[model samples]
Structures are given as structure tokens and as C-alpha cells.
Target: MKKYLPLIIAILLLALAYLTGYSKYIGLAWYGKATLIGGAGGIILTLGAYWFDKNRLNITLIALFAITTAVTYYYARIFIDSADFEPTAGFVWYIGYHIGVALFIPTVAYILQKILPQSASIE
Candidate 1:
């Protein structure tokens, strides 16, 4: 229940971004902003979980939530202003984007885990 809130929010955000035709303005700044917001939210949610004695923090999921939120926000902004918005493209775009992220996150995280300081690992 409480443990699932972050994922739920992430999914909802992605759904709105894609379904509402808002991906046209997505860009780096948008990604950065989303990342910061998602990360902060994850931290807060983790704290809540600890206080509530529900599920403990899951670093990988937290990272996925943060990264997905950031990416979704960027996609929304990038496509939001497209004059030729095709309603169908949103679904296709979401599937393709998520597939890419699914493949990319673990690999990138693996590399980062090796290169970055141990403190930086999501765990």
C-alpha cells in the first residue's frame, strides 16, 4: 500500500505526459528538474516508509522511479508542443522509451557502481 505510492505516482505522471500530448518540450533542463523532484520525493517517501514500518527502501526501485519520472517529464515537455501530434505516437513513444530505459538503467547503474564512489550507489 504505502510502499507502492512512489511507483504509482511515477506511472501516473508517465501516463499523463504521454496521453496528454506534452512531450514536445522535453529537454535537458526539464530532465534535470524532474530528476531533482523525483529524487527528493523518493527520499521523503523512504522516510515515510521507515516511520510507518512498512516496506523498507529499495534503492533500485528508487532510482527507477527517479529516472522514469525525469524521463517522462522530459518526454512530455518535448512532445507537448508538437503541432502534428498523433495520438497514437504517445503509446508507441512510451513503449519504446520505457524499453530503452529498462535496458539502459541496469547497465548504466552497473558501470556507475564501479566508477562512482560507493556512497553514490542507490543502495
Candidate 2:
């Protein structure tokens, strides 16, 4: 389960992200701040799996989490003002956003750790 978890999460997030981004029907409805207990709540719950080995407080992960959270927060501040449907100012929502913009480097690192030959993994 641990080994396959990342891929599973990636798939699920990819799906939600697709629905939320591409579909015309869904968009922000309510206005509020969502606090995740830890690690962007690790949107990668759905996303942060790649960074799981590191403690949630690790500076790198923390920075990534902050970036994702801030991004979503601002997306709301700048784009979403009311309860009605409005065309998105951007192509996608940056928070919890399918592995996240801030997390891309980590995800790639995680993938490399898994896919590249074992010899290459030697530190």
C-alpha cells in the first residue's frame, strides 16, 4: 500500500482537478478559509504523498505547502468574489492543484527515486 500510494493519490487528484477545472458546472461556491492540520493538510492527501517520507514540518515541504495554500487563497481573493459562477481568471486552481505548482520539484524527485535504476539512487 505504501509503495503504490503516490500513484493512487496522483490519479485521484488528477480526476478531481480535471472535473473542477475543465467542467463548466463546478466552481467556487462558499467563501472561507480552509486550514489543513498539517502539510497543506497535505493536499497531496491527494498530493503530498511524494513528500511523505519527510516530516510535515520539514522546511522544503513547509515552503511548498505555504506556496500552494497562498496560491489558492489569492486565487480566491483575486478571482472569486461572489457566490455566482464566473469564468476562471486562470486555467486551474493553484491550491491542492494536482500535486501543486510548488510541489512539482518534489514530485519529480519522488518519481526519480522510484523509477530510475537502483544504482542511480546511491547517494
How do the residues 31-103 of candidate 1 rate in per-residue lDDT, one tens digit apiece? 4344334434444554454455433334544665686677767666666766657864565464444433342
TM-score of each: 0.30, 0.33
The local distance difference test score of each candidate is: 0.45, 0.43
Candidate 2 lDDT tens digits, 10-76: 4455346444653123322121232112223333442453345432324555676687777777667
Off by over 4 Å in 2: 1-57, 82-84, 89-104, 107-123
- lDDT score of residue 39 within candidate 1: 38
The residue pairs that clash in candidate 2, if any, are 39-42, 44-47, 44-48
